[model samples]
Target: MTTTQTFGELDHPSRLLMGPGPINVHPRVLRAMSVQLLGQFDPEFTGYMNETMALYRQVFQTQNRWTFLIDGTSRAAIEAALVSVLAPGDDVVVVNAGRFGLLLSEIAQRCDAKVTTVEGEWGKVVDPQAVEDAVKRVRPRLVACVHGDTSTTMAQPIAAIGEICQRYDALLYVDATATIGGMSTPVDAWRADIVTGGLQKCLGGPSGSGPITISDRAAEHINGRKHVEAGIATAGSVAGNGRRIASNYFDLAMIMDYWSDKRLNHHTEAASMLYAARECARVVLEEGLQARFARHAQAGAAVVAGVEAMGLSVYGDKAHKMTNVTAVVIPPGVDGDRVRARMRTDFEIEIGTAFGPLAGKVWRIGAMGVNARKHAVLTTLAALEAVLRGEGYGFTAGAGVDAALGVFS
Candidate 1:
């Protein structure tokens, strides 16, 4: 029997989200999102939009003029970059090392690109030589990869790969969704033609906005495929002679026109998410990118030290591991989900469970954005130690917290 029950004013439990993503939002970003809404085409709103673009330029460390926000999550930006630049039957080489890497290949295939993949071990970054060899042999039009795949907690080295793409005259697109504000991603220095990221990870905001930057080389290709919708098409609108992009919402050229002085109406802008993204960038820049990176690095190291001191093994090549997330191997005979549940129920904390081949074998703990701090790291470690002990996992008492504090001290 169902009975109508009116829901009361919204309230929720407070939890420490020490997981792969969708972590706690920054208080400043939350406040920014609560500001009064503005008309999409209002001068003040457009001014905020322009400020967002300029702010992300500093965030992405690029001077590219086409830098802007996509009114969607990280994957939307990925699709936009690929679908706009890759026409039917174009060759693309994707490096598939982790879950996010596989996602790159999946999205590329849906775009009708003849996708070839270069595989790497799950716990390791892709080898630049392998990518170079594949590009040399395949002569691909595009090279796509993830900067950091949280699934495996591995951060790929992309500078040399970018140089290889340049030598072969191929466009390089990177999903920096996991690494963007937590670490350094110098788009121009890395030679990435297109780079996309989300606000949820290290940006300390909600997941609705995707910040992206494109070099002139990549922009030219996307602009070539620009086609205005018939409903809004003007006499001045140039009918794109190229193949129409497969997805309307994910089209970059039209999005650029909407963001430009043309002020062409596309989809109504996601106003609140834009404000959140703006403030996320503002907070990050105010802290200084390098300092933010260092803080995350220290927090990540604390996680590693504490986990190891507690007799758990840290997964992946430490040298290439992301500075915001750490993967710890689940101890023998310990039920991963059961331990995670105790952590949640008793400690009000959440750590990540792994995916793909890594499932059942490891737990991922994220220290990024608003949660990347000494207290957050130590709190998670303390909770994890207690949970592990309850799960019949033996460890030296106080070792984890002690080691973690050592790092901060």
Candidate 2:
């Protein structure tokens, strides 16, 4: 006997995604993804790939020729960058500021690198001097850092640390997942050797493709570990002298050839995701980088002002808060989760809860991507005010929206 299961057509309530990331994608990006697919090696498809590389080079604010997308989430490129450059027993120093920082150290350990973690306060950016001290003490082969960590809502100041890495002759790897399109991530200005980002945050797209840019220095090192797969290798293809990278799928050297004019096959590209990524960059560039950044900054400021007016506090060091997300302190005696649930059920909006040490202490609110606008900010603040009031949290009525409007004015 055969059995059949019936499922309803795809439908879900529209939500105001005021969370850390995976926020609402831009309409243009969505439309772009709906375009018909093309063969990975088709001339038209390869042209689109080349265009995407050029677009992300501007997104990363770098002239690096190795700029391209990794066909996975942000973490895939993170793993690829770490594992490719770091051989077994290589020394690497990771600056830990929040949850994602710990992730870096973890990935580096998996790469079999000798990991030295320089811990920083959860809600504050890491001190550049301390990083320099670690570099001097460890003299590691590579220094890894996160540009923006949403868990703490802190944007680490990396220019000084990048210079420190340069002075120490260590390759600098930066994960700019949360800040690339929303803020300035001038790779050359910061002297970052390798940088990776995703589209889910400020880039106004879904998460799948991880955009990466590699300096000549880092690319040369990654190329040193190059090994072509036997199925696709030509007689002229020869493996590099360095240790072979452990993972075949996340190999950057082979990926480079795949993206390069050589057009070597690594894996079939995610066609729809490539469309999304390309359109996302196009949107950012069309908006102009500085203008888009200012919009994010303004939206963040509006949230901060509104929350403060609502008699709540913002988490983390204000001096270094990320422009895309705000961690609002859950007032004493208020059930944070209950408030979040009501915010969803009653208001059709979604905010985030904190993780680890900050769990139950704060709620993260985001005004990013296409949501970084006056109306979205005010609407979220108004809905939040209603939710807080229903939860018996007292504040002057209309204060949140009023304050947010003040920011816009």
Candidate 3:
């Protein structure tokens, strides 16, 4: 059996990835990926990993020693968290606000945990009070929610929920895949015991690695179940006769040791991915995290203001939207895909479309990481205005750009 490669048939796009994730990586981070790969155990590589962990700790705003990268994409971290904390038949309550929330519930169920959902509408956020109420009613052992549901580009409020969970003695985890870097998520202050994110989103890096932070409390629980396999356990490492971890590759206790002074080997960590993660966090710091976040916020707001001025309505509650992503309504009669196609083909720009019920009804525009810039914001807005006009949608000319510019001025 063999495989073949062809370049001619591919629809390679230079999209303005104004969607949920896997946004265009920063040039420096991309360059970091090209550096020579050192052995996973190489002193230099391990040093890089150590520093990378430190950088991510700052990025996540946590002092938790368990903060480290999960080798796969964002979901890997989410699964690791869910499976590690959620014992079989443990009561878990998921705050459901959008597609991502539903996905979280589905994942917890796969772990054999008893899962309950606290519901909200597609574009709306899960109210914290509802979560408190659900905790009181269901009394789950764990509470999980997606901080930003990219499908609707909405940021779920977690501060209150975390407190409520703490009061009820339940674990609180956040899948901050889309909102971590570009938005403000002070993990420790938010009382989030566990938080996970992807490098591809706001970090302006590749999608191969994920960063997760666990509080001291979460780490103690995780380490309690640590149960190092016979082959690797030292005298002090957590050991148990408990059944082997459900997923061999994803067990984080071993990963924590690998990253820690224990220096035990886990599957060869991706040196290049680790390099990229380090550089991605570097970019955020060099640019200044607060400044970078503000840029994403500004650019996103610009797009919303710009497009809304062009007569297209923005989807959902406007007050608490995600800073890095936006969901805009596709005007009546304009084919969403057609407009997106035109944006990519002619304007060299791209945006996202909503999922589930909002599918075909919304256009997702992203302003994140390196993409969150004045030029990107202005260009996307102006291009969108022209594309909408070309689609024969009636709107005031230059109103969108002007509206967006006014914010900065």
Candidate 4:
């Protein structure tokens, strides 16, 4: 006999998240998500979608008319950007520096790109000259890289790489998911042909919506894959140049029609997530992007200062460290997992663990979006100091919090 267990009411602990991503959402974004849903094609709902597109254009700092949201996480946007433009056998040079950079390579490969990689150490940014040299040698159709890879807490320098891609007549694609709202990424100014980000990081929202912007040059590449659905195809309509995009759901050409005045039906949009994305951008713009970035910078510096004061070394190349996340070397003779578990259970605070080569060697602490504040920084530092002491890792009592507070002062 089998027994079916009945579950109790759904509830979760209110932990303070100071991690690489999926941070606490802004209150306004939460409220926006709770609003009543409207039909996808309802005039009111479509108006909101259009407004969201405008809002994200400002967030991406691009004048590209193709700026809009994809109904999935940041990786979905990455795949859409790559698969939409990259035909089978097209050469793509990927800058591999960290986990997300590796992800760019993986997705390009799935899109059938002839993937050539320029590698760097996990905790360091790929040198622009290296990327330029690779692009020159491969003569790729696209150059893909990660702007800020959370796993290593490193932000790659994109301006020079973008210039090199331009010189090579290759489209430049950047996964800016971790850095967009927390740091400055001027897409057009950097000469990026495609830029993609998610709501779960510094945007202060959930992960469903991915905001992406495409320059006219990139749009032309993507539009070449456009295909009218057979059911909706018109007798007089013409097909695009390239082969049909592999994934119908991620096809940007169809998504463009859905967002454009044509109002062509694609998939039903995730309306609540759209609302959340819009509110996320609204709050960032309300606070002023520059001020918001400065806030994250201060918070990140405080975390670094606090860790150093506690006698811990910061990991990675300090010059290329991200403004939102800091990686601290795990003290020798300490169980990193044990310390992190204690911080969660005792203080209800969440930090992150490193990935790949840095795993078990560093702790990734984040200060981003709504958590990029003085209080969040001090609280995380205080909890970390207590946990380290309990774990028998020697550190000066009160030094972490004191040093963090000094940054605010």
Candidate 5:
């Protein structure tokens, strides 16, 4: 006779989660996820979604009336934003500084948008003046850039680029998934029309939830294609046939209507993930945006100081380094993966490996969100110093921690 094995939570495994995303979740978020489920259309749940939207608006620093979760990971949010805006043969210029920007251009191409690019080296940021000059030359329909490209630990300047797009009458879109919440992103001041981010990075939550905010200007352009159900779209609500929307799932026109007074159906919202995203935003506001930025700023500085004290050099322009993550050049003769593995198993600590050309050459270290604290920063430094020493690198013991402590002091 065949027997069934007992299934339980014990069967699960745990990870240190020191990579690019899905960092260690706050305990409060875990508890929130354990709460009982509610019907998607239930009044209380709908209220939760509204609350989530309001909280994200404050996080995004936007007064955009149409903000909501995209119900997937960060890439899903990217697709939704690009697909809805790009029709066949539309022109798009992606300022490619790293992997994410390339991915965006690829996705836009798949959506049939004619794509162009201004490429930059992997550990370097795109110059705003170059982007402005490109906008004058390309005259594309949309200009998309990544605020923080984790693959390179570089943060591209967006303010002037947005200004250039404004002059050219092209919409400005930013993928801030790796930088938002951990860094100060004044969405309104920057003139970003569509901003999309993930819950995993900087937000102190798991993946599977993406929150996006779209300005009324962007909504107006998207609303030109409002294609709701024929029977349901009433006389005053529905637009002409030319205004019918493109993708049904990512239709921001109808999405805004559903999320707002229209109160129409879309999809089953991810209730637990929404709660986690809401709480993450709450933590940022409660701490005050300035204070939150200072924490990440200090921790990132401390990490850099610590790494330098160990006789290592950090990549990229120091002025352009991201507030949350850093890229340190891996010294010759030391195995990057071995150092990372030891940091994980021996110390219960984690650090990231670099990608692209910098892969195997730079170590990506993060001081982000909930992990941006004196304890995590100093501990990671101490552990790394020890591991590098054990691997026969000539370095003084406690050098990393001492350097970091000097900064905190």
Candidate 6:
């Protein structure tokens, strides 16, 4: 005797997403996602798939032949990379600079790898020397770290760490999800064996697709553990000599064969997400990498300058901060959540809250993707100034906006 209520058409508020990620996507990417779906193996769709691989090669600054997309969030790529290459009992050294570093360690542990951690302060980059020391001690098979940990708004310098890994004969894996496209992640120069990113950050697209590049060394290790599924195997198929990778969906070796000329089927491809990822890379290259990096740098500087002018302190080592997100210390008497709520309800802007230790103590303001521009920076600072004033935090009127304008000027 109960009637089911019908919901109206789906709708959402138009927000100026200045948060850490999933920021305002580019119009081009949105349009790309609206295209009609195609069969995964359709010749034209496959051509687009090939193009995506080539496009992300330029985005990641690598010539690796194993560049492609993992059809999930950034963490999916991270898990795939770790599980494929790390057999049980393998050794991995993780540089723990912030929350994401802990994530790396946890994933490696789940892979049954013996993980050795080099812990660093939350708001500071892990010293390259410390990572090198760990590598020397553990003689690990792999060294993993996050390039930019938005949790603390710190960016680890991976070039020196990469050199250390190379000298010790360990593969380097970087979760560049927060830094790629917005900052320079030179895979070749850093000698990074594996790098993974998501479209939600500076790539100016939605989540659900992870872009990844793997060096031949890492690919060979994964191939050794490759096992084609029985459902799709032909007579010529043979399991590799090494242990089969632990996860069926995340096996990178099979994914490679799927992307290769073999056209093997794994999971059904995420067609719309593929469109979005491809367009995301296209938009990035169209803007040019260097210019995009400079834009993110300028936006971050503007936010820092604005907050300082408003008598707010920025968290973390300034020299090692990520160019995309700025962590601002919440004033002692102000309610941090109230401020975020007001920013959303009143001004229609969105900012982020910190994780773990920094939670409730800091606010993360992102200037990423299509929002990393002068207008967006100024608007956020101006709204933040109003909200803080309402919260009874003392600061000179217009100081924040004026300082941000100075950066743009």
lDDT (CA) per prediction: 0.92, 0.92, 0.85, 0.90, 0.83, 0.93
Q: What is the lDDT of residue 262 in candidate 5?
A: 59
TM-score of 5: 0.93
After the best TM-score superposition of candidate 5, give how far the Cα of residue 147 lies from its true spot, in angstroms. 0.3
Query: Which ranges of candidate 1 are over 4 A from the true structure?
Result: 1-5, 229-242
* Candidate with better TM-score, 1 vs 5: 1
Off by over 4 Å in 4: 1-6, 229-242
lDDT of 3 by residue, 176-229 (tens): 999878998889988989999999889989898999999888877777767664
Candidate 2 lDDT: 0.92
Clashes of each: 0, 0, 3, 0, 2, 0
For model 6, the stretches where C-alpha displacement exceeds 4 angstroms are 229-242
Model 6 C-alpha lDDT per residue in residues 1-409, reported as the tens digit of each score:
9999998888988899999998998999999999999999999999999999999999999999999999999999999999988878899999997899999999999888999999999999988999888899899999999999999999999999999988999999999999999999999999999999999999989989999999999998888776664366433434552367889899999898899999888878999999999999999999899999999999999999999999999998999999999999998999999999999999999999987999899999999999999999999999999999999999999999999999999
- Candidate 2, residue 383: Cα displacement in angstroms equals 0.8
Per-model TM values vs. the true structure: 0.96, 0.97, 0.94, 0.97, 0.93, 0.97
lDDT of 5 by residue, 46-112 (tens): 8988898898898899998778888789888888888878767778889898889989999988878
Candidate 2 lDDT score at position 263: 90
Between candidates 2 and 5, name the one with more favorable TM-score. Answer: 2
Score candidate 6 by TM-score against the native: 0.97
Better of 2 and 3 by lDDT: 2
Tens digits of per-residue lDDT for model 4 on 1-409? 9899998888989889999988999999999999999999999999998899899889999889999999999888988998898877899999998888888888888888799999999888888888888988999999998999999999999999989988999999999999999999899999999999999999999998899999999898787666664347544344453366878889898899899998888899999999999999999999998899999999999999999999999998999999899999998899998888998999999999987898899989999999999999999999999889888888679999999999999
Scanning candidate 5 in windows of ten residues, the lowest lDDT window is: 237-246
Off by over 4 Å in 5: 1-16, 230-246
lDDT of 2 at 347: 86
Consecutive 10-residue window with the lowest summed lDDT within model 6:
233-242
